[model samples]
Target: MKLEMLDTSIFIAYVVGLLIIALWISRNEKAEGRNTEDYFLASKSLPWWAIGASLIASNISAEQIIGMSGSGYALGLAIASYEWMAAITLIIVGKYLLPIFLKNGIFTMPQYLEQRFDSRVKTTLALFWIAVYIFVNLTAVLWLGGLAIQTVAGVDWMFGMIFLAVFSIAYSLYGGLKAVAYTDILQVVLLVFGGLLLSYLALVEVSDGQGFIAGFSVLTHELPGHFDMILSPDNENYMNLPGISVLVGGLWVMNISYWGFNQYIIQRALAAKDLKEAQKGIAFAAYLKLLMPVIVVLPGIAAVILYPQLTSPDQAYPSMMELMPVGIKGLVFAALVAAIVSSLASMTNSISTIFTMDIYRPLQPNKSQNHYVHIGRIATLVALGLALITAQPLLGQFDQAFQYIQEFTGVFTPGITVIFLMGMFWKRTTSQGALSAAIGSAIFSFALKFTFPDLPFMDRIGLVFLLCLALTVVVSILTASKEGDESSNQSVSLDEVSFATDRGFNLAAIGCVIILTFFYVTWW
Candidate 1:
């Protein structure tokens, strides 16, 4: 399974192309009157297309391109559930969540929390989210991207990790959200194209005797348990996690938290020019989510047929690239770099936003914009430095990178999701309640990870979410004001906004429900 040494030409092309895009966007970031709002929020004037591309690009990090593809290679098509179910989640967020945030003209999710709850609650959530955004999501992005480059190009993942970390910091350091969003359009296109090309080629290679449908048919039939919906904990399969219920449940909660509440991902939609563009952007990302499995997952599935004896599952992507023609290999490698930078820029901008607005401003008020933006640039470089160091160990343990990240996310997502939902919609939700819920949820997840790691992990997300919800309710009720104690300084009423999706979403939902049902029943 060993492949050729890294393709230097392709690697150089990818890195150079990304730098050009970032530099190109950098020119417009500091225009007169652009200020922080324009830089961070795209002047609140992004169209649906840009927002949509940014959303998908930021979401489809190297983790999904490499990790999810590896999951498909090992676990089969059922793993596509993660990408597909996300479509439904996006629709929910678009139909209900977008209007609330857009109508209020909020900047960060934590800013919304502050307006809805209190400063303490807002600051706590913002700080926690920034940590998770960097140490968690940002780390995973750099780790996976570096691993991919190392496998394909022998560039020393340590150096690749630094390259990604520094590149992300550079533009996000200078341009902020405008830079992040504009470059994301190019990244999104590259990711989709590179992935689709690889998958189509893999299918074509295998289907030489048979057609596309026939090749997959041969694979599904000849491969035992190829379509199995349920995997046993005791099964010797390398891909199976400890618990089925937990895996399914954990993934569902994680995706919801990411798509629905995460500030970094949702910031693009918030920057949309209007409600219509926001709605369109989110819904379009939803459609792209549905297509992700075809672009990403299917290739992993096809890889099993091409190189079945590889010791490391993560190598599936790199191995596939080796089989590609020389020029295409260079382009695909560039695409991988694009995917990595998109995530890096996104995380850097978000971390800067939370720190500057939520932390620096409140503690050190009356600072000049130049002074703060300077700090933001400094913070960007610092965050990138941290992210690079975090990925150092993961560079060698590519096999465990995906699992390690999931375990880390399992610790934070449940409670974070609950507090966000409550803060957004419930007028009764109190600052005390929000803080208490976060603390309780964190403690509960830590206990699970350390004390009872053998139990179902996904199932725990539901328990944690419910516990936070109940705790929030009790604390809020006890501290509930008779008058106006619940209102934050930025409160507004948007209970009557209407956001009707096209009939197409309904039809797609119906179609997906039926197809997923058939998949589960037949595979199980």
Candidate 2:
């Protein structure tokens, strides 16, 4: 996958073009009178298209491009359940979750917690999120991005890491969420087009240039094992994909935690002009999710057909790139870089937003909005710096970066999700009950990981979530007041109206479900 001189020049030009666009957009923000809302929430002015693009762009980072491809090489199309299930999750979040957050008019997820519970609950989870974003999410993106560039271009991994961090900060640090959201439109376009081109070229190579349909037929006929959408229990990777459990078990926990509650992903929907625009944006993103496995996952299966002798499954994507023609190689490489940088920018913006809105503002209340904006920019610099320093070492511990990320994050998501779901929908969940659930879930996750070493990570997450829910219920009943409960004042009322459905959203959601069902039934 080494680049020729012309290819190298194209790649360099693509990088420079992104910087130019970012700076041009940054100039739109006025120097003075820039408030916290302008910097953190894009002044709440993003349209549906931008929100949809930004959501997909932010989500499909090096993890999906590199790690999930690796998983595809090892686990087959079964791995695509993550992406397809996410489409369903996005619809659910739009129909059931967004109304609650939007109605409260909160900028951060922690703010919603404060409204529903107490400041202590908000502060505890906010700190937890900041730690995970810095140590896990941010660091993993940089490390995987660096590894991909090194594999394709022969650049040093550290150099790739720094380049990505600096490029993200250049636009997003100053212009804030607006800069990140607008530039993502270009990022998503390049990502989809470039990824599709790569997949098409690979299929053509596999069929010896007969055509896409012939190539696809050749692919499925020769490597029929690679098309399986479900894994049998006897299969070694069963715990990871586990046949029907992917539909009924902990995969739901993972998808809901990510699409419904994660700060970076939800921030785009939150920043939309209004509830209708946000719902529309989410539906648009849902459709895009249905197409992701074709672009991101199929190439790895193609590599299995074409380059079976390669030792590491992680090399699947890089090996596919080596098959591309000179000019197209660079274009595809640019798309890879675009995916990495867009995710980094989205994460950097979210880290700053959470820190300023949830952490810094509460410590020193009633400051000028401009002053808070200044603090946010500084927080972005610090977060990026921390990620650059820590990414490589953190990633070095894992053979498969994707699974490592999933297993580690799985430890926390179950507990966090329980607290949020109960707080949003139930009237009796006390602050003490929420706090106890949060703390106890972390302890139980770690204990389970060590105590029962053979338990699947997905099972661990489901089990932890149930335990947390039970604990919250018991603790709430014991601690509830005889007089009017104190927590009732802060409780969110979830009546039938709050989960109302519309024609457009309902149609789109049903379409996504039908398409996913068809894929599973035909492929299984």
Candidate 2 per-residue lDDT over residues 1-524, each given as its tens digit? 57888888988898888778777777767754488888788889899999999999999999888888989888778899999999999999999899988877889999899888878989999999989899898998899888888889989889989988988887678888888999999999999999999899888998898987788898789878778888777877887777777888888988999999999999998898988899999999999999999998899889888899977777788779988788888988999989998999899889889999999999999898888988988988999899889897888767678888888888888878888898888888888888989888889999998998777788788888888999999988888783246655444776533677679989999999999999999998
How far residue 335's Cα lies from its native spot in candidate 1, in Å, is 1.1
lDDT per residue, candidate 1, 88-187, as tens digits?
7787787788888887778888888877777887888888888877777777888788778788777777787888877677666677788788878878
In terms of lDDT, the poorest run of 10 residues in model 2 is 482-491
Provide the lDDT at 396 for model 1: 51
* Segments of candidate 2 deviating more than 4 angstroms: 482-485, 495-497
Q: What local lDDT does model 2 show for residue 216?
A: 88
- Candidate 2, clashing residue pairs? none
Q: Mark the regions of model 1 whose C-alpha exceeds 4 Å error after superposition.
A: 1-18, 208-211, 230-250, 394-398, 448-452, 481-484, 487-492, 499-524
TM-score winner: 2
